[model samples]
Target: MKWRTLENTAKIFPATSGKKDERVFRFACVLKEGIRAELLQEALNKTLEEFPMFLCVLRKGLFWNYLEESKLRPIVREEYRTPCSAIYVRDQKNLLFEVTYYKTRINFETYHALTDGTGALNFLKMLVYQYLMLAYPEYVKGPVSKLGITSSTEEDMVEDGFSKYYGSGEIKEEIPRFKSYQFPYHRREHGRMKLIEGLVSSEKLLQKAREHNTTVTVLLTSVYLCAIAKDMSIRQKKKPVSLMIPVNLRNIFPSDSMRNFFGWIDIGYDFATRSNELEDVIAYTSDFFKRELTLKRIGARMDNLIQFEKNPLIRIVPLELKYIFMQLGAKFISVGENTAVFSNIGKINLPDDCESYLDYFEFYTTTPTMELCMCTFQEHMTLSFTSAFVTNRVEENFFSILKELNLDVRMIVSGDSRAGQEHFPDLSKETATHDFWYRLFTFSCLAVMVISNILNYLLIPEMFWSRYVMGGMASAWIITSVGYRKRRNLLKNAVWQLVLIGIGLYLWDYATGFYGWSLNIGLPCLILSCLAAITAIIIFFRLNSADYMIYMMITCLAGFLPLILNIAGIVQFKALAVICAGISFLTLAALCLFQWPAVKNELIKKFHV
Candidate 1:
């Protein structure tokens, strides 16, 4: 069967609103040390020159999308910068060797759009081991047979031993169930990770989970649940905190993409609210979530989404106006939505070759952006733990949980990533470009936003109640004020903005269908409006040094903003659903460009006078 291009209007709702689709994420881990950065850089230069495949990203309808920026491959880095470095940045690493370092820490980052937590973990373990030999002089190094790399050291390691999972497998087609709707794409607030990267086997972790009378995910989830509860209790004395564990629909569906093939299903009970017995909490959560993970439920969810997207129209209201209502509903009600997500990618496999030389993997879960994500992966038997948290308190709780489990963390290490650690360093010392032309470009962006908002306010009617209008206005307002001092209260205001947009989108759908308006017009606007809104917030936060709190507020805002887009009249344009997600991604990319004022200012400085 030919892989079809995702429709401009994707079949969202059931399959994960394309907003959370598998195709959009990517994960990469760096390994190597002792060698000068230049050596690794040279190796990367050779590798890319040798094999184009060394740098690629996944493409729509295609399994792999390599880096379009080939000369300098854009690597998705997951940098661990805490316990010393706290900033995490994602970018392209020109060379594979730069990722591995015996002198410094290794770096790893994942693209949620590419693969789920599990899939990325497999890749990370292998990537790390490959780096180990190349960096340590004792591990293994020969002519880089894989992608292309030449190292000075030589060690015996089987490349096949590194990877533990399959690229291709029996695919079963099953549908997943979840409340579906349409909204803009968003980037969550992501924080630093206190990572514990080790070597543990899947078999051991599963056995442990079973021994604890829990599923692997449940057992891992228990760690997070316990950690979060502890974090909350230690902090502001909040009640039981809720957690969301992303259940891959593909796991139950059989026929799902290995990439972006999952949905975040809630999986936490208030730790403080949990039963006195850990068994009760574990059993209840395991059982409850276990049922939610079935193919039947997934199918029903997808089926309902299909129906919702395909239903008949209500030809009474205008398209734009209808969306306003749905957007409103989403904002007022949904966006401040689910509390937090705690996901687990069960024991993962490194490629067979690197297995013997490798350790386990680590990953983090973020929604919009999470308060903290307590994730663990078992390689052989030792459970490697990681806690992605914005603050020390949240991290401490995660560590405390391991102690409670009677598993003492054996070691702690830190890494230096120009991307993550040097995130927003002082601008005065940096030197980039400060061209007059670039200065003009900066002004041009703000100018364009100003003009766009002005045009929107002028062209859009005041009386019309559509989510697009609300979202656009709100988004515009955010961007306009983005360069100013931060506004914490705006978090709630932003929440309301998304809420209104959700309501407006829902209502506007009815108006468009009832009035016999073209869905093409209604949907593109609706979906793209979500695109814009999510983008605006992401940009706002990204410019502010990747602030986790703001990201949390905005992602939560975007997550539930689309429920009503399919209400009555709107047709589910899955292709457009994908479009919304893609555009939102673009928005995020744009924001990432401006992540650091010094870097941005450098460019302007160079191009300016």
Candidate 2:
């Protein structure tokens, strides 16, 4: 089958997919009756024929990962896992999406690299519409006039709206960049993302937005910023609380592309500069919407992106190199800006007959921090929050504002046995156990530093910093133990711990005066120790040697740094560098000789050379 490169916006997703952010989203439809596996499978098979773009697998190309049509069909089974799990393209060769049913819910989980929420929702609506039609032919006997249920030509469904809108002669103006504030929260836990959803009265929310003279998106953004401001520490109040709002371009641009076609706008408020009142936030967000969310501004942003992509030098770079740079760019963009993301898919309108069988729809997107996905069906508008943090203070504050506005809200926890409608609980008291442990560990580290410093002052007057260095080493051990206990991934946890220890030891050695020990002995020893540990892990565990190829390459790469420093005359340590280099080269040679085929295949897959 012919292959197609990912959309311009879709290119970053594959590189950004990780445990913290899987770059996946879920659009689930709740049916009034129980789901039938056979009917769902049949419906999926039929739907793929109409939406052939979704029937493809991700494949590595020289310059990028492309999609090729797959011969294998998707299986419709019971939903046994959490929502929005990682979908490794290389492992699941046939499909980029999964169709699973749990009781009355039919979930369509898709990787964001393949399609956006708009595309995924369209496909899901068709799948469910087809299933309902097949199960009860009498119900959908009339004309099939629904947007997604009706057939669409391949040309229209697979059109690249970005290319269509790209203009060569467009003036490239520098748009103002905003450095938004980030929340002062701990790093994400080592497992799946947490999901919390609430169903509210759509009419009430709309009325409230109308009263404030703003749209739903602006109102929600304002409320979210207010929530963050309420939960922020006094020191954090000095910065702006920003929210990233994704805007679908299909509405503005003329295109029938079901693929990714969207842009994002950052709306923020600096509590230090502006008042923390709700009215001020809403007014500020409304003004931003008026200025930045216009066609001219958005079109200019799109043109600049397209122009950069069309650059001659960037276009010729190999895919492997591009992937590395893209990963770094993605991380920079995510962490450098925005506190949270609020994606409003707007109200979903279904046919009168199909509406009766469907209960409500919930949407969620994976995020490194907190994300809110909003959609409305009938009278219910659902806001789903997917977060990495265990604290729910922001969520509590958000809903509390709505309650004060006299909007009736219903809460639903994903894994909670109390599935039905219930009042919103006090999330302040609902803390995860990990939160407690993290606080305790942080406090203990502080205590250790203080006591050690006092002891060093009394006993070792000349080396006052010695005890603090020891305390730092003790803290590294504690952090590594906690990480290992939570993730159970020995290789990842151990490598990070080793990195921390190396950094601490080097700093201590430097503090005692310019000593060659850190570079000549300490550094080489750390590199050699890593090599030994990784080798033992592969052999004793009887694991696929190919799986550790990247790790092995990284160790060899680190070993080369010392040699480079010595060559530059910065480090006068020839013997240590020579020893480390010899060991690294020998390990690489052994792997190449014994596992040549595996190493070759892995390199080809990763580098796409």
Candidate 3:
């Protein structure tokens, strides 16, 4: 299997992501006509052939979580699930992103650890272009070139920007921190979220920004700060209304990597001390942008973040324990310091010929409290608010402020629990039926024992035939339990079955007669069989030796036990036992001689304490 380490900023997402905070973002492109699932599936298949990095699955190592190459392929289906629902389930080997369609919209939702908004948008654009080429061959004829995308090599798509740009520079002074004000509203039950999208004229918004002599991002951010302040009470007004804004690092550094190449800055306004009017807020925001958006400030922060990944002590800590510390830091340091998140993805660009098939683009992200995301098409400027609060007052206040500026704002609202309730399958009913049948089978086995015992008591008292039935039932349960416990890992399952069955054979041999066949031949032969199975697995999967070394080590250690018993004169057989021990010793020696570093590294990570 091929694998790569998660970048510096991506390490925390897998740890801190949960039901309330899914850490998933969505990008959708609405076309002029309704969607066709077949053509869209073909488009996805073609898109994945070029972008293999998006097809990998998230796997956990001893020290870190990584992206491992998987054989699982994504299927494009009609949209039935809520937007930005969870896509990365721990221990499951599914793809990290999903593509679905709803009427005229093509939705692409991805796990944050895979890529950021910029990387995701590029992939989405290519997917749309491919679908267009296939759907309408007349208007958009392709010569195998990606339309509306900057040319980039496949290697550049997976490059780690943080590793490329970080250096051993002097650390700057830390920025001052404060506890930001949060919304004093009740949260919805069962992880429900509300999405509000407001569409307005892009040219009008740009003109409005020009009148204020600032960029569109700073102007909207000022309006958002004012919107958040509208809900603050007298006591809540003392703390600053802070928002965490994600900045694309590719703008500062020279790279075309499609992975997560982004950094964030926290911009806040003190409503209690400063003026709360729009013009005043705009002035303060424009100044903050000028000061924090410099290369010196961004570089200092980027270096500080990457420094933690380089620590020797931190690298040695196990992934499970590291996640605990990560979760704590997120709750106390990250969430406590920022009231909300805002990401401005700027614009969605396409070729002039391809733009005729598209209506507009929409973007949003999942959040525990709230998040506001902005993006623009040719004439449409979309400001989407994703909130977990029970009220929509923040979104209401946001667009209302824009409307006050004489901008024609159009609003579309969707809820988590309402959109797809009818589409969810009743999994609980199926589980209940399965449990009922399993319990009934066990009860029938007990009843058969009772009936057999009564028949023996009435007919033959000397022979105990019912005991055979009882033993058979016990063996059935043991087998089922073993199979159920290790179903996920096939290599481990094979080893465990060999051990358990070998012990059972020995017990049966002792009970029937003391022929010593279990120890002399049966156990040794089974050990050799396990060794062969492990060898087959490695060859079949074309796997790295380090990936399966732990299994190999266990089988080798078990192989010596039969020979040790024979040396102690406990087993009479010698040839098979000697062969098994000799083969195990030779394999271990070869591993230590040729692949020692990888084997040793695996051991250190597993037993780091």
Candidate 4:
């Protein structure tokens, strides 16, 4: 039940998260056989015991949101959702990580709030090791001991390394900041992040880098910059195509914490300022790496970050307000300050026994514009390019550079193959036909309403005729609501629509007559029906119940309105009101009883009173 404030660097993730940028990272382990659900779940349970930090849920504190150990358990399932989808702590309060298997691949996705790639990789390693031991006991060696799981103590695993190293007030020197060149933002089609992976021989790539007198990361950064430069307009050519390189701090600061302990260095090449030669880009990147990768520079930057967090004014602000400022800060820091991120986890070295059971390791980071993650296993090195932009010109140019280097590259694209196609087949005819029917139906509804209203006004002047018009309008609304196409969460959207219609119907009935039916039956029935339907969907679909708790709570609150109306003598039906109140109270009480610890923890974190 212990709670810990988020690490200094980890605070930005929740603030910056949005529909397109989820702030989640994916680390997939391709196993030799299909993942056994039972074994994986068991393995995750066992792994959680050792790395308890990863089992925590995020909660809001007065000044900042913190992580607290969750009472719920992590479950394993088949992979169904898209990779790197948003992991809302409110929804999945138990764990900040997800484990799913697709065929032979075990996908381990972690929210950046909980841990960074290094921490997640350690957790995944242990999970896979345990799974292998359970599934193929004959092939696996010793019990998790030989898996190279970090021997860091639980205290160390949860340690705020940034604060540990830089919290002291002694380092007061102000570090100068510079504005880097920005890449022009392109709107991604449908806001779907696309991943394109290229597998090349590790030896060939290393040899090519050595010939240029640079390391793999520097060489790859150079090539990536070259690719970006190709698409730069004459106006943009003056700006530096900066690449943000994430450096793992564990190597420098010597902390065993699995929490976020990383720093980034911006490396750039200005085509308009200097030669766009590959060698020049490499040398420039190498020089920057040599200077910025040093502990002195990184430590100074960490100190500067800590100073901002330690500001007295910042410390007193409420969490909600802090979230707004942090979001604006994250956005301001990102826009025009850098081009893209290049995170290289380097070659993954597994124990000899476990190596044969694994195929390859893949890493993906959610990016605002574009991100490239590099990892190598055995002879093949894979460079994964995840972009928010639809076009793959940068990726194409990157691989084309490798092809020129005489390296045999194999490309694999996730999602649609027509993503980067120049000539998209015309769908106007199909869309026109669909729109035509929709417009026709809409026009028909409007015409009926107008004509019926006119005829009723003209012929039935003595009679109340607006009811017919109201009926027509209701019919039109119902048709429109039902006919609308929802691409995602269709059932949830439909349920909401039904609830809205139910409310409208009750209001209309109340306006027509204080018929005891709407209040006596309709309102209570709608409340109970929505509750029942949503509960059934959650249970049947095996969705996370925490995700729908807010909706259920709102329904319960709405249920009370009927009882208040009854007390006010607006609705004379006492029986229905009592029934509605009973149901709402009982449901809410049940939630509190079952999830008291989580609820209490959430309140403590959110209100901090």
Best by the TM-score measure:
3
TM-score of 4: 0.71
Give residue 461's error in model 3 in angstroms.
Answer: 34
How high is each candidate's TM-score?
0.45, 0.69, 0.77, 0.71
Full ranking by lDDT: 3, 2, 4, 1
lDDT of 3 by residue, 528-552 (tens): 9988988898899787765578778
Clashing residue pairs found in predicted model 3 = none
Quantify all predictions' global Cα lDDT against the true fold.
0.40, 0.77, 0.84, 0.76
List, residue by residue over 1-609, the lDDT tens digit for candidate 1: 011122111212112211222112223332222334554444444434433332433221111112222233543333322222211112212322124333333444443433344444434443444444455555455334542222211111111110112222222434322231111223322333333333334555566678787776677666656555553433322334456456655465443232334545554364444563556667877887767666555454444433432334422333334345545654555543444555555444443444454343334332333433324333333333333333444445555665566554543322111223332122234333434554565566666666666776678756344444444554544444442222333443444444444455545556556552334344445445544554576577563332223333244334322333434435454454455445555545555565545334323322221
Candidate 4: stretches off by over 4 Å:
89-94, 167-185, 414-609
Q: What lDDT, from 0 to 1, does candidate 4 have?
A: 0.76
Of 1 and 4, the candidate ranking higher by lDDT:
4
RMSD to truth, every model: 17.4, 9.6, 7.1, 7.6
Top model number, lDDT: 3
lDDT of 3 at 252: 87
Q: What is the lDDT of residue 500 in candidate 1?
A: 49
Q: Which residue pairs show collisions in model 4? A: 60-605
Sorted by TM-score (best first), the order is: 3, 4, 2, 1
Residue 302's C-alpha lDDT in candidate 4?
79
